[model samples]
Target: MAKTFERGISSIPGYKELTENMSIQDLPLPSELIIPLRQHIGAPNRRLVSVGERVKAGQIIGDSDAAISAPVHTGLSGVVREIGSRMTQTGQMEDCVVIEVDPEQEKVKYTADDVSHLTKEEIVQRIKAAGIVGMGGAGFPTHIKITPQTKIEYLVLNGCECEPYLTCDHRLMLEYADEMIAGARILSRVLDNAKVIFGIEVNKQDAIDLLKEKLKNEERMEVVPLDVKYPQGAEKQLIYATTGRSVPPGKLPAEVAVVVQNVATAKAVADAVIYRKPLTERIVTLTGDAAVQPGNYRVFVGTTLAHLINSTGGLKPDVGKIIMGGPMTGWAQKSLEAPIVKACGGVIALTREQLAAAQEYYACVRCGKCVDHCPMALYPNYIGMYAELGKYKQAQEWGALDCFECGICAYVCPSRRPLIEFIRRSKRA
Candidate 1:
């Protein structure tokens, strides 16, 4: 049966019972970790520490000359074992600092006595010091994202966990309501004074209620339940759905005078500004039919999939595929050797049935279902076919790079063709 969700808006159609919030597995910690410096979108970090150097939790190990780049820090107490190029999910080789965990390394959490008494500028500095970045899959430096050339009147707190089988954002909204609001407020200040509007899909009522309760006195932060829809949390889409202003194509949210931040990213901001914590750990949701234990987890960066899977009581024998992030924009891992990086949203262990179901792609029948579901109103079949034909320049002429690769067209494709995958190959992003 084709699933349809009612998210409260007409254009935001399809999907209803968004199930996530599992907490079943606790994988063993890795003996060694590999923290990559080029986790964000900008220039990759340059290694500052050499092999055999000791580092404590939160100590800077990588630095960059680029202004847009942020430094990478040690996630655990360890000695730098080696530094070499490693395979990344994007299929590139990059420098990776190997650290052998001491196991007894102390955890240093960011702490603040009170945020109410803190000045706005002070909060922004703390956010910068903590090395926060957009947690919504784009590892863009969070501090830089907040700083605009002009003032912003509206701040959209992304609560829409739009991707299927990923509920980390939903769980964060439900469980960390207070922190989310506090973070949202700090982000608003970073924008030179803007009232925050927290946007969640209507499907996450529990998260909405919890946030509402926590925000009882927060008139500055308004929670609006968005119509549940894929890509609702997307920068352009969320801005449009919340403020009814589309971010001009090939432009940024700031072009519309809006700043969008994910709920999880907001919480990370709070941790940096209010709590004085640097970016280290994040919430990861593990699910799928092969998942013996499924739910949300608070995990440190650099944790390996093998370690996480073992914690979840080991992947089911039928586990045939593992995906990182949400089903929509998520990638099927080439192997279990990959470690969780800063941009990872979820780790899904798929049952053999689920894997087999999506194993094959047939020729498109020209049904036009993909075009109907594309939020960008793009012609996915055309895009896919063009890309497969190796016409990169022609794909760009068709606005291929601007597709945002949200995966909606592929999701709704009846032929199950890899529309977005082709776009990805063409864009080479």
Candidate 2:
């Protein structure tokens, strides 16, 4: 049986065929890289290198003593060109370390480590030193997530790449299943060998079948096929769909004895623990209708969107919008200069025809479509209205902060109201 959350728009097109079948390819290093120091959600990292300083690949360039933050590393050997503020994918100006790529680069060698005798704290320290975070767009540090104070009973692996036009996680599941499973086992060991359940969407039947076959002999791991729906991969929704448990509002999944980690994040963990590798690169889906060559590329962090788009064949003449991540919840890029951070999974180039309907929006008519489809079951209409009037406190009273910004409200709204934008404003306020 395919499990799903109570309510969310299922009619949205996935558009995943563009690159779902494509194998991951390595992207050529760009001339320059703009690596942001504060890629995770917690405290910002202070620069550790000065301009004109030469650094090696996988070297920590930025770090913080804050418990909630992760360090930043350079993916390529280069000379520090500048350290200044730049606009990141989040649409905010953050401090960045600019590195000019060297014509000749040094390669970092990784060797597999024996984890049989490793302790939980050692595993967590390795993960933290590797700078691994939630690669499924949340950008939360993984070390803190795995070290919850409550006893965890379930470890949910999010393989439901529900957002349209994004197939990086699906590809990771298909190509790196063993690595992901190994990483999951590592995480489980840290969590006292909690039962690992993989919640994959039905749309990726191949992944589900493969994982099921692989895990049939494993007693502590199982695979659950999830109903195809937007935001089905969300932490709370995936937990409910897999375990029939609900995480209360303003509460973490740990409250319900559950912990959810993205499939890509698991893969990174395996690399970090087994091979003692740092997270300096990730598989990014360079896709969409307007892309000349739509495929998945293993891109280094700090690579610019312009370099990626130009390297993989530039966009079509009719391209109207370029977004970082999936269309439903991704951020629209105003300038191609924005660099790819750890959490960036896809770069979509939509044609003018595709974005035509998104040009204008009107006042909400209270059609209740947003309420009917919101996965969180919060009142987006009232929140948007209150936020539009700058009544952020009222918006909070209507459950603005609880929103994960899934964009289902704006997607199903009859009046085309930018409910996600308004909700974001309210949260910021």
Candidate 3:
């Protein structure tokens, strides 16, 4: 039985034109990289490299023994010019290791022809050492997810790049379907051979078809076409859509015998276990009205957002805002200096006029539109109201913390109320 989702927007403005005929391109190495020690959700990694130290590409410059954290590696061979604090896109000031690229330096590649002989525990260890994390924008360490307290039943791969203006995952599915499948197999092994499913949106028929064709010879895996809705790619929503399992509020998917991973994360697992590549780089969609050249980019993790934009033909003169990810759920950047991290899936630049025209906030009009459109079935209006009054406890009672901050409520609010922002504040409070 397929679990049905209640409410979500079917169409997003300015999304269709961006993904059409998109292909992956590599951004040439930048002159410098500011690698942050805190890219994952857990404890920040401890700095292992100091200023003036020469480091090779893929070398771990930061690590932590904390069970929840992931290591940070240098994306390029360079000498550390500075090691200090810098504000990331998420507004946290973190220790950033600044490296000046050594153009003459040669990169060392690590590849293993045979990883099938390795045990499951050894494979997980390799993934942890490589610093692989959820690349679907959450940045949860992949090793921690594979190591579950509950007995796993289902392993769902999120190929639903439902977020608007992001096509990197779509391209990855089309180009790296084999890698993704291989990684899924490794993940399944880690979970004692849990059933695997690929959950993708119907809008990406190409990716779905490609994966299906590739899986002809494969077994124990299937492709699932999800509704073309905002937030369909969200972990909980994907789990429910594919497996008919709803994760309890404040509970994890593991609680429901489900383990979810992004397609890119799966591919990274394959790369780490087979090719010995670290999580030093990722595919990022650089698109929007302000982008002179909009396409998917294979970018190094620590490269500056500005450098990425510039390398890809630079931004338009009328650019107003630069977002670190997709418009709906991505964080707005105050400056382009924010380095690309493991979780970043796209860098979007919108013209100021366009942003201003689209965002005209007004007071909530007591409309039930937000409630109707909320996929989580939480009352956004009441939560926003309670949050505005600083009644966080009341907001909590209304399920504010349960809100995934998908921005759908705000998108549907005719009054243009920033419901997601209010709910976020309440969650933090």
Candidate 4:
């Protein structure tokens, strides 16, 4: 048995029902899309097209020569209406390309004349061209991750969609199992045929069984069942659960000779390599009681939150907050105008009642629940306390930066303390 990470919530109510019997639905294209230039972590891309310039679907709209960045593409054939700044989901203002969708437009289909003759270098090139990133929300470039400095020995595909109220990955595993498997094969080859393991939570037994059956003949790849817990899909946690390899703090996965990519990203790699397609869209889960129709959607990148809500019969009048990504780590959006980016996995519009009740912070009674529930095994309560006292260096020493903000500390806190928020502030400081 694998030694799983200590301190994780076993379950959260109201999330499991959203994953049952859910199939993907195609979202209607938006009238206009706001494509941000700085979707990835590193330097933002420069605009390649100006206002009034016509662009085809999958056409590169922004790119940079920087090594750490990836290109950004438009997902629809349209005219560039404006080039301006817009607020991204991360609360950063970035240059955005506003494109007005052409009423009668045909999407470009990618088809590689030959796929079997492709080399590893060719595969990397295609992935870079496709603008594939860690679709699980990190937004790191996929090509760069696959090309590591150390000799990679393991390539882990994360299928543990452990976040509450988010089922996009689960649906992808069920719907695009074969494509994902092919992607794993391609990625393994890119890593010089490293051992590939698909790590999924046991709750997704259907996905596990399907992938296992599909990968029986493939010697280098296998699916491993994981414990169903919050933050189980996190790269480090998944790495430890699947491979029993612990990545040292403040180091990349390459330090341990491991390459971790999300299941959706793998499928994207396969699509990019085999069909020469760029990542213009992805599966997004629009769920919660606020959603009139809760289901998975093949949403085009840059589509507005309002367009998605309207397509799904709009939000209930009693909706309280709209979050992008999962409940534990997702960002709360003030408006529905925010456009979907490459890293966005799911949009959760929670009802007022479903939302957690607001609470005033109380002095920590030195109860160790926060520490007890911290997956990183850091003293979250102390970090929060040090941060509140403006002793940021002390908080850093307590491993505030290592906190992935899984929200478990806050979730289990009896004092209703905002430990996660304090830790985030300390990291920023």
Give RMSD to native, each candidate. 3.4, 0.9, 1.7, 1.5
List the candidate 3 regions with Cα displacement exceeding 4 Å.
Answer: 1-4
Clashing pairs for model 4 are none
lDDT of 4 by residue, 1-429 (tens): 323555677766637577446898898778998999878878889999999999998899999999989899988998999999888776667899999998777957676546678888998999999899999999999999999988999999999888888888889999999899889989998999999999988878899999889989888888898878777888888888888888988888889899999999999999999998889899999888888898989998999888988978998899998999888888889888789998898898877876656547688988898887777888998899999999999999999888999998888888888887798889889
- Summed backbone clashes in each candidate are 11, 0, 0, 0
For model 2, how does the per-residue alpha-carbon lDDT over 1-429 read when each residue is reduced to its tens digit?
898888887899889999999999987779999999998989999999999999999899999999899999998998999999999887899999999998788777898988999999999999999999999999999999999999999999999999999999999999999999999999999999899999999999999999999999999999999999888988998999999999998899999999999999999999999998889999999998899999999999999999999999899999998999888889999999899999999999999998898889997777889998888889999999999999999999999988999999999898989998999999999
Q: What is the TM-score of each candidate against the true structure?
A: 0.92, 0.99, 0.96, 0.96
- Maximum-TM-score candidate: 2
Compared with the true structure, model 2 gives a TM-score of 0.99
Tell me the deviation in Å of residue 382 in model 1: 1.6
lDDT, each prediction: 0.77, 0.94, 0.87, 0.87
lDDT of 1 by residue, 1-429 (tens): 112232212443332223354532344667888777778888888898999999898887887777787777776888999999876655567788889989786757555767777676677667766777788898898768888887788999988887777887877787777788878877887786697888887777788778778777877777787765677778888888777787777888888899988888888888777767778778888778788877788777778777777866888889888888877788888877677787787888777886677889999999988777777777888888889899878877777887887877877787889888899888983
Top candidate when judged by lDDT against the true structure: 2
Q: Judging by lDDT, tell me the better candidate of 1 and 3.
A: 3
The count of residue-pair clashes in candidate 2 stands at 0
**Candidate 4, 30: how far from true, in Å?**
0.7
lDDT tens digits by residue: candidate 3, 1-429: 223365678767637467557778888879999999988879988899888889998899999999999998987898999999887877668889999998775868676659878998899999999999899888999999999988999999998888888888889998888888999999999999898999988777888888888887767888888877778888888888898788987899999999999999999999999988889999998888888999888989889998998888998899998888778888888888899999899888889887885676777788799898888898999999999899999999999988888999888887888887899899889
Model 2, residue 144: distance off in Å is 0.3
In TM-score terms, candidate 1 sits at 0.92
